[model samples]
Target: MKIIAAKKILKANDQLAEENRAGFNAAGVYCVNVVGSPGAGKTTLLEALFTALKDRLRPAVIEGDIAGSIDAARIEKLGVPVVQINTQGACHLDANMIAAAAADFDLAAIDLLVIENIGNLVCTAGFDLGEHLRIVVLSTAEGDDKAAKYPAIFQGSQALFITKADLLPHLNFNAERITADFKRLAPQSEILQVAAIQGDGIPPAADWLAGKCAATLR
Candidate 1:
C-alpha cells in the first residue's frame, strides 16, 4: 500500500505539473528547474546568472526553501521579479507550490522562469515541476563522489554545473572523474565549471542557457 500511495501522489503532482506547463506556454515563458545539494552554490549561481542572462532575456525566479527568505531576498535585490516559497518541513517543492507562487509573477513579461528547487539532491529530483529543462549544481567543496553517490539528480538533469570551481586547486575533488561520470551518466547534459562569486564561466553558462531558451523554448 505504501508503494501504491506513492504512485498516486506522483500522479497527482504530474497532473498539476502539466497544468503549470500549459500556463507557462500560454505566457510564452520557458522554465528551467535548478536542483542541487545544500551549500552547492546554487543560489550563488543564480545571482551570477541573473546579471549575465539579463542582456538577452527577461528572467523571473521562484526560490524554494525549507525556511527563511534570505535567498529570495537576494534575487529580488537584483531588481528582478522573484517569489519565495517556504516549504516548511517539506523536502522538495511540488507542482502545487509552483502553480501558486507563479501566479505572483507577470509571466507574460518574462521570457525565462527559473525555479530554484529546495537544496536537496535526492527527494528533489523525483518531483516534476513543469520545467522545460533541468540544471544540477555541484560544488567542489562537496567533493567529487556525489554524482556516483547521488545519481538520481545528475541522471535527470540537462546541465551539471560544477560550482565553486575556483576552489578546485585547493580541494581534493576529482574534476576529470566527475566530468567522466556526468558524461557517462547523462551525456546529453552540458557540463559547466563555474565560480559564480568571481564570475568565471558565468557568461558562457548564461549564453548557453539563453541560446537554448531562444532557439527551442518557444
Candidate 2:
C-alpha cells in the first residue's frame, strides 16, 4: 500500500513537471535544476555564473529553501530577476511549487532559468522539478566519499561540480579518487572542478551551460 501511494504521488508530480516543461519550452527558456547538500556552494556558483553569463544570457533564478530568502536577496542584488520559494519544512521542491513561483517572472524576457533546489542531496534527487538539465554540486569539505555514498544525485545529474578546489591543499580530499568514482557511477555526466570564491572553473561551466542553452533554446 505504501509503495502504491508513493507511485501515485510521483505520477502526479510528473504530470505537473511536463506542464512546467511545456511552459518553459513555449517561452524558449533553458532551465537548469541545481541541487546539492547544505553549504555546498550552489548559490556561490550561481553568483559567479550570473556574472559570467550576464552578457550572453538573460537569466532568471528561482531560489528554494526550507525557510529564509537569503539566497534570493543575494541574487536580486545582481540585478537579475529572482523569486524565492519557502517550502516551510519540505526537504525538496516539487513541480507544483515551481509552477506557482514561475508566475511572477516575465518568462518571455529570459533565456535561461535556474532553479536552485533546497540544500539537500537526497530527497531533491527523487523529485523532478521540470528542468532541462540537472547540475549537482559537491564541496571538498564534505569529504570525498559522497559520490560513492550518495550515488542517486550523481547518477541522475547531467553535470557535477566539485567545488572548493582552492581548499584542496588544506583538506585531505583525493580529487582523483572522487573523479574516478563519479565517472564510474555517472559516466555520461560532465565534471567540473570549481573554486567559486576565486572563480577558477566558472568559465568552463558557463560555456557548457551556454552551449546547452543554445541547443535547447535556439
lDDT of 2 by residue, 138-178 (tens): 99999999989999988889888999999999999998888
Candidate 2: C-alpha lDDT? 0.92
> Ten-residue segment with the worst summed lDDT in candidate 1?
1-10
- Model 1 bad stretches (over 4 Å): 1-9
- Estimate, for each residue in 1-218, the C-alpha lDDT of model 1 and write its tens digit: 34444356589899999999989888889999999998899889998998997767899999999999999899999988999999998999999999999999888899999999999989998888999889999999998998899898899999889999899889999989899888888998788899999999999999998888887665
lDDT of residue 12 for candidate 1: 84
Against the true structure, what is each candidate's TM-score? Answer: 0.94, 0.94
Off by over 4 Å in 2: 1-9
Q: After superposition, how far is residue 36 of candidate 2 from its true place, in Å?
A: 0.4
- In candidate 2, position 185 carries an lDDT of 84
